[model samples]
Target: MRFLGFCLSMLPIPVIQQAGLALDRHLGDKAFEAQLEELWSAISTANDLVSKVSTLEEAIQEIAKTIEASPTLEAKTSEFIASLGSNQKEFSVLTENQSYQELRSSIVHADISNFVAIGGSTNVIQNSTVNSERTHLHATDNSKNFVDGTTFQGSGGAVSMRKITTQGQISVQGSGIGFGGEGGIGFGGGSSISFGGNSNEVSGNCPSCNELLRMDKRELHKYIHVQCHKCKSTFPFKLPNA
Candidate 1:
């Protein structure tokens, strides 16, 4: 599989374009085309062959799965795979190799970018900001979620908020997973929700009194200068691990 990456990366620009054109002709489905465009883009710009190869290999596996869904595309898929290698022999090595097939099956497609995150932890999110972005947050696996000193527990728990202005803190712990975002905090065991921008918001609790402090949407994008009615305390909001 790596040898395939080396060959593909080292190919002349002309040959690479030829190969891309060949795949585009055969693997012309919209999905495959999008994947190919990304693959070629990565190949052309990749500075680290190791990382590039790793990423491309996963991409190839995904393309294979798409092809697998349409048995009629098998021949075209073969041709596309062949175009990746230098010759028929290399193509056979890629197609006939047991490890290569196993590698494809083993891929777990978890896409986490700055806009997304997933994990488990005993942690705190405090004194931070979650800017207006498309962010999804999840907390799972029987964990305790403490947002602004208010506890949200049990399964299927989620809080969706556009903006959060708080002088509060969030803590996640126990045998579960917790995902944090930029602006607000969510505590739960099985719920997942989108958090950010031009939507309704969930209020926070005062760190000193654990009283719900409703927020004003007008306060969005400003530094935290929240007042707690119960304890008469004022403080700022911080991001996870800040």
Candidate 2:
């Protein structure tokens, strides 16, 4: 029994050496290794936390920027609040809708008159007065206005040039008539016929008369019998052979 106990206590050289190595490995360096591992784990956890927080903070800031940038949301919210607080109807009102449309239209279509350019001479004034179609005002030195077409004109631009005037006369006389109509005719701007105080014949007759009367070849041919409507007188208008 004693020998067995002593043998057990001494043990084998390989077993003893292995035991010492295990002790050194487990007890001696274990504290430092554990401490290093613990510190590394803590540092890793802290880094992860920091990364998560930074990501969260960036997300939050982005959300705030998005909110700030959204005009429709803010404007709608404000309008809703205003409507709720005021006497505004929940439904659309004509005036409000019109105002909204007008505001949007004004924003979209801003007038820029400076971009517009007016042509022609500024030295010559624009004639706003209405003129007869028969008359045309020129921009010459006299600004000579001429009646182009035949117009039975009295006054008030009734094809009489009572409206617009350049620098010359109120109504200019025309040259001649053209085409055919009810004792009246009109043509393009090129042709003209006009009347004045002196052009009017005052023989004091209604249907008037053609002053030029000459014997034509029709009266000399055969024995041409003609009856006058005024006197009912029948007369042979044939000339005797010489």
Candidate 3:
């Protein structure tokens, strides 16, 4: 019995199951039942270990895939950064080019032959010369007023100028109408009398009492003092060439 136990212990555990079954058939079931139960328990533990090892192998494969794609992701990131740097360098070169510098320093001359501006305010400041055939500005917006103050020493051609505001009074005061040329008339070519709207009539409200002051053709080119009838506050009203 001692020799049998020593020999069975020396054998592997898997073989021990078959050997114990054979011994049970030969000798009896009573002597080898505990050894068979222990062998079965060892087999269950080995099967569990095999299942855990299979799961561990799948996890290792996923980690290997991630590691293999890391270089591709890093390369794409580097390529994106390099593209931004290249675009910035190209933009810097374009801004520093000779043509770009010339465009920044060049003079812009716009030839507006026949121009008509309606419904807004326009300001023209000519230091040297302004040659125009006909220039007309009409302010149709009720919320704004048209105001023109031009001072020129010389002119080139005939200019028929007309400025009208829809809901505001027109104020024109300057030197001579035309400068340095014959028939260079200004502000309705000396035919217009009142200056407000297209109706050739000018009217305004008193600043003190809000009374309406209407201008007739007699009061067109005259420096007159108007008194508000409501509040009797007198104010000076002047016209061009008066």
Displacement of residue 173 (Cα, Å) in model 1 is 51
TM-score of 1: 0.17
| lDDT by residue for model 3 (121-224), tens | 22221111222322222222322222222222223432223332222222221223322223344433222222343232356889886867554323244446
Ranking by lDDT: 1, 3, 2
Clashes of each: 11, 4, 0
RMSD of 1: 21.6
Q: Check candidate 3 and list the clashing pairs.
A: none
Candidate 1 CA-lDDT value: 0.33
Instruction: Please say which candidate is ahead in lDDT: 1 or 2.
Output: 1
Where is the poorest 10-residue window by lDDT in model 1? 100-109
**CA RMSD of all predictions:** 21.6, 50.2, 42.7
Worst 10 residues of 3 by lDDT: 97-106
